[model samples]
Target: MGRSDVRPSRSSPLAWGVLGLWLLVVVLALPLAGQLGESTEDEGVDYLPASAESTEVARLTELLPGGDTTDLLLVAQRPGGLTAEDRALVERRLERIDALFDVAAGDPAAAGVVSGDGGTALHPFSLGELGEEEQGQAVGEIRELIADPPQGLTLALGGPGALGVDAEAVFESIDVTLMLATAGIVAVLLVLTYRSPLLWLLPLFAVGVAAVAAMALVNGLVSWFDLTVTTMSSSIMTVLIFGAGTDYALLLVARYREELRRLPGAGEAMAAALRGCGPALLASSGTVSLGLLCLTFADLNSSSGLGPVGAVGVLCALAVMVTLLPALLVLLGRRVFWPLVPRHGESRATGRDTFFARLGSSISRRPVTVLVGGTLLLGALALGTFRLPGPLAEQDNFTETPASVRAMELVADAFPERSGQPIAVLADADHAQEVREAALATDGVAEAEAGREGGGWREIQVFATDPPESEGEQATVDALRERLAELPEAKALVGGPTAQTMDLADTASHDQRLVIPLVLTVVLLVLAVLLRALVAPLLLLAAVVASWGAAMGLGGLVFGPVLGFEGLDAQVPLLSFVFCVALGVDYGIFLMHRMREEALNGADTRTAALDALRTTGGVIASAGVVLAATFCVLAGMPMVVMAEMGFVVAVGVLLDTFLVRTYLVTSASWLLGRRVWWPGPLGRRPAAPGQRAAVDAVPAGAGPRGDAG
Candidate 1:
């Protein structure tokens, strides 16, 4: 791992070519910026439920008496009581809105309009189901029509269409917040890590190039394959780019510092740093990319989209880290660390047998004490797992927001049956009557509307008496679905607010059942190949699982009792499992790799474990701090899911870097002695002269307390 064996000269033409290609890709992707821009139009039609189940109901309704129609609920209020002028003005505006979308069948005044509570009026605009783009356009036209609205009349539009517009606006704000927060965190963390103005800028610049290039590449791929990017893609990019970029940057700079200590000149040090850290960076990036690729297995479109986009960002960051970062370092040389210089003729201290040195020694002396204490602490946290709750409904997703909370309150008061409940049932042409009859007979059905079609296929809409996410509501829907299934005429697909919640719950359950084992297997294979030892990966996997369970337990405590939320987000466990397992293995890899390297060089088991921690501990700690801070910013988002995710990831990374990798791995290696690498060739005594000499000087069972010479 030393600089002298693998250093690449700064003046090499190969390095410049790599840098040039990196710049070329970035420049090429700039043209696709328009494709990445989010839609800003607010449309009333976009707020309606457009799921497969909803669409079937709408299709069937088209054949009914009045025909299938979508209603736009226009709510208008005034400061005082309703006046003649206020009513007149609202009537005029409603007429205008109806005209904007050709709402009237023949006469313009035919559009349905109702005045409610004397002070407020509800204007219902009838439009059939509209596509997303069409709905966005319609909403924009409606907004423009009311732009110069009359005095004493304040208007707010709601329904399915309005919800869409509000969701888009909220999502946009979240995007901007996450981006700014991530950038601020990365900047501060890098500055603290390097304490050099120039070095601090390098990661930002590299990641910037990587991000731009990755997005452009993703855009091109999406266009070519006809893949749609979700509203959440930008947020995913923010996390992946910053997280991977920081990881890569840390590996490079840590190596750079080590090289500077070893080499006599800056050019040599820069070259050595790149060459030494290059393979490790590539290996790590590959693993992360592979881990993200696993997201393709997800049944949900949102999660699947994240897989490739996240993988692209990681791959791009790796390219920049290895090529552009190294070239820039070469060009800057010692000036990259201008204020901090290496003292001439100073030998870098391995720092083995320090405080952690004595700690590891003590743990090795009493392996049972260390193991028992760690297990008890983790197990205590695991007890909270039983209290974990299921996935929340769409309304519950925004339950923390003031507007949503207020809206829920109003619905509960005025329209309890309609409070956050929308259900749709679909059946084939022959079974429509039976299905509709069964649906109407179902208990807790507040209202059941039959479809227009007289043929076998008929769509039914059922409004439930309870909120969609409630257990009673779900049980009612499940019963209705089962009874409908028994009807001879229809083949039913049940979906709507309650159905979507159930679908998400099923998806999360399926993902956990499949993904956890898959990820663990992949990680084990990776560790096996990297360490060439079976016991190490097994122990490492155990520690990672323990950490994940502990994080879940802690999250349950926070969200369940402390925050007093119904339950933790359904996706929290999945997120914790993936991130904690994948990222936790990173620390394991860093530790075990260094330990193996030392052991191969002939150090005794105890000395090799201690020395490996001494060398890799600082970088691991710095990396954990940066990653933890970056994840912590998610707490500021409006959504409860984001807040819970942020907290868990932050805590998980801290435990992984500090507690597990530093103390646990080192102590386990020391206690296991030579058997740590058992059933592997490395477990056997080294045949090399250097290894024999190092091992003989440090004997096993030499009383874990010793001085570093």
Candidate 2:
């Protein structure tokens, strides 16, 4: 199709109108964006499946007299046995600790338990119905209350409450930290990629607007749809906005530059650019959004919530980039390109002279060799999955060993026969005694006793003989659950910190089984519809899946050996798969779409593959680096899950960008020739000198076309 068919008028007023509209959106969204943090919750319950046993216990607890309690452990330990003086010091500290809880809504405090070894004492405290902030402050006061432990005696706070405090401390400033870090990374990468001081600012500014808008939308989702947003989801959303928005900006700007060399004015150039790349952008965002939406099928609350949260970020980025970015670029004119500006009628280097073009030529000469080598490399990397450790334990969740974790370690070592973490049994009040009796009879049970009775339920505090989160403890919990299951009248539900972790891991596995196939299907259908061919979409999907495997393999090697992570989080594999497959397919779409466009426009299979790579290669590289770097920011987070997630997605994106899209996909397409477009017109028709496909010359990819400046 002719350029005139798709181009808007050079002097259109839409650019100014679009700019004005986006400014209004920013003004309206800023306040709501601030409230987003207010809606974010990071409790264990928040991550649990709504229908899980642990979730029901958590829910039932909140309905009791004191709502939810902040349970903490005060540990006093020494290498040598406690002397009379040390015992008296522990007694005095216990009094002070009791006073701390006594002031908080007058909740009753339990007596301290001295280990048989006489070297350690564990005192459990509860602050009833405290808000998150109040809980943190209360934990702090307790720490201060026992700050002066006698020289050899080590005093530390452990238990769920202390752990929450440490975790919350890491997440408290997550949003601001993530935004600043992501923006800084994108800015640096953008400057390096574009090599123009002025050019970097436009995309950066546009992406910032997108992030603000996305946060506001997310906050609204929280209020309206009751969407769950955790620090992990929100942080990932922020990274997605900056990374994806910048990527879109890069692609559009590259296309606009190419158009500028041929078109008469900025408006027409941008209109033509948008017209060319618009479908691919829409298709790319659609694939990502739909793929994320597949997470809604997950049973885990955090995983399900992340689907919509991330989709919101991607959609907002797309809207701003397609509208606000274009308006800004058109309004600024060719001057934004500065120094490397494309002047009308200027002749420049063609694809034949470009690095990607040369690389494509070499691959085309020996397509099978490149394809086999690339596949073998990807397969080898995938073998690293065998090296991946088991589910991440609670103590291993943090990148650094917080005080709580250290305390837990001491308590575990001191009281080797007893579990510090309680296994809560929520049983029918009518049959509470029977459930308690059964729990005590379980194989791993060290102790089981009836506790709080309210809201038609009775709490049974059960302690396993094994340490918390140990394989043996998990087995005991399973045995107790089975015993309770037989007592139909009891309707007992086992929950607590350990139970929650088990449920999360189980649910994560279930989610993987359910969501993975759905995501692949959604992505496959999108590719099929977009490309209008079965074989091409299948090939793209295979390449994407292989890339994901390679990325996960790299994580297996890096996470434990290089980063000292204890083990992979239960959720990482599924989340990473969704991200790598969904987001990684983006580069594939840009390449394959452009290649099909070239094919329909009279280029043979070889020329189409080479030109597509040559045109899209530079911008895809820039976008990939920017995105990878943006996610790499998560590595600095104190949370192991976030760091692992960041590493996998970033690696997957880099692999997809530099290797899969550039070589494997290109070589495969070249070898397949027109057969890649099987069941489509291109599959049947031989290359004719003057014939163009019925479809318009749909432009995609983010690199300069040959010999046009």
Candidate 3:
């Protein structure tokens, strides 16, 4: 239990080679990593459900005359009423807008309209087909052109086009901001955990190398395989590399430090450390990578794209942590630990294992009480889900209200009966008239009109009687789809901003149902194989799942009442669950694997459990804190989706680490004893007196000694 048996000095040449190879990879990765942001796309088609009606419409819309068009509403208002000067200023601004930008050919508001309340004037226009980049530029220019309105006249730009511009701004800045913030968080945590300024730099540097390499590789995937990379996916990838990479470093380094006490040389000690903890590292990485890859089955394009992007990150972190990190550490030798370096033949009974040993003893004294208490606590926390808010609306996606959202509010106040964004219905040109008539006849339709025709398809712009994303608006969209479906050969598709949001939300729900089970199954099978037991994997799986529920419930409690967020994003639940199950299971693997090793070495069940907890607990706790803090970096992001995801996953990791893995799993193991490994060789009681016993069937350390409690 004190130290691993050291092998010959075999790591010198391998370490040097790994170091050399990593230096080269890092050099090549720098520029490519910088270019990764350029490849990310935040377009509607990039995030919409692949097979949804909204996605198809988005695709076909690009085939129209001006590429994909953007619509905008220019609003000018005064609280009391619009005066003559206000109208004149608005008129001049409208003329300037028309002259500067290529307005769509046919617009109802080519000339501005005054509201009946006499306090507002609205002008609606669409930019002629422009690329995504060009669209953002156009919106920016328009905002600048109409920067400050005359006194008493409030001029604001509002529409889907303006909203996209605002969102793209956030997306553009996310990469640099996220990387810096995540690095800072990890650096701080590592320094605190290691209590060594010098040692912290090595893991942080190695993780940074992994991040750059992952980014370069991900960008290559985008270019070659047409993988979708969104700002959120790319940001999460950076977090995964840093978080998972640092966790691996902590586990490996802790084991190496332990080996250092018994082994004479650093090279020999590192080899033993790698031998001891390598399986857990590989299993941990594999579980996370495969769990994320399950996102490929998600209907949402963003969710599916994140699968490979995140998997690539975890794999890159694994590669670098095992090879580059170990190589660097081995070459640096024991002094790299500085101030508190481990020496040969040092005492094994340091304070490191004492706390966890005492904890294990306490839990073992009343295992059933501990187990039942933990379960009830998790269940009570899970009830917080009932307090969760509704699905986030488009205008509420940002943590702070951008100008576009402000404009939307202003427009909504003035134009209660009209929606600034219209629902688009695409149909066969042959049946355009019939589809339009049917749409007009639909219960929620206020008006329907023919739009551009291209590529054997005709676009019909349908205005709903209700505002966008409202219950009434969604109902209208549903009614239109149903009404249009009955038309003979119409092949009509209902889509628009509202429809796209609906599709994304529905797809998220479907993805949660699909991906959660896939992630659980993948993680369970992995645990079963690793532990070589049925009962243990099931126990760990249930622990992480329950931990997820508790974390999400905590999120529900925090997101609304504490954070003041309006509602949860559609993607948060699925993404958080994936990370929680995958990453949370990591600590369970570490603790259980060590316990199994002890049992295999012929230690009694009680002693093995306590010893595993004693030896691995500190490092596991440090890894958990690092992972949790890294994820908490997401809370700094402006996007609600990322913020919520970061909060839930971070909470779940902490709960799994400090609560379930530390107490619940240990207590359960003590109670189950050999049954914890049921159906496996280790699970069986000693053979009958006459029969030969299995290799691990001896009762040398089988009894639960009272002092172990």
What are the per-model numbers of colliding residue pairs? 13, 1, 1
Superposition-based RMSD of candidate 1 using all C-alpha atoms, in angstroms: 5.6
lDDT of 3 by residue, 262-359 (tens): 88888888889999999999999999999999999998999999999999999999999889988888877877887777878878774524888778
What is the lDDT for 107 in model 2?
22
Judge candidate 1 against the unseen true structure and give its global Cα lDDT, from 0 to 1. 0.66
What is the lDDT for 667 in model 3?
Answer: 84
Q: Candidate 1 or 2, higher TM-score? A: 2
Ten residues in a row with the worst lDDT in model 1? 40-49
Question: Residues 1-709, candidate 2, lDDT per residue (tens digit)?
Answer: 2344234335448988999999999999999999988899998788888779889988887676655678777788887777777767767776776665643332223336778877887777667678888889888988897798888988899878789899899888677888888888888888988888798999999998998899999999999999999999999998899988898999999898889888778888787998889989999999999999999999999999999999999999999999998898887776677667777777656737678777876776566788999999999999998888777888999888999999999988988898987898999999999998899888999999888889789988899999988889999889988999999888899888778888888898889989999998999899988888888999999998999999899988888889999888888999999989988999999998899888877887666887888899998988888888988998678899999999999999999999899999987887677878887877777767464322112134321222111
Over all chains combined, what TM-score does candidate 3 have? 0.94
- Which portions of model 2 miss their true places by more than 4 Å? 1-12, 100-111, 689-709
Candidate 1 vs 2: which has more lDDT: 2
Worst 10 residues of 2 by lDDT: 700-709
- Candidate 2 residue pairs in backbone clash: 261-709
Q: Whole-model Cα lDDT per candidate? A: 0.66, 0.85, 0.86
Residue 289's lDDT in candidate 3? 95
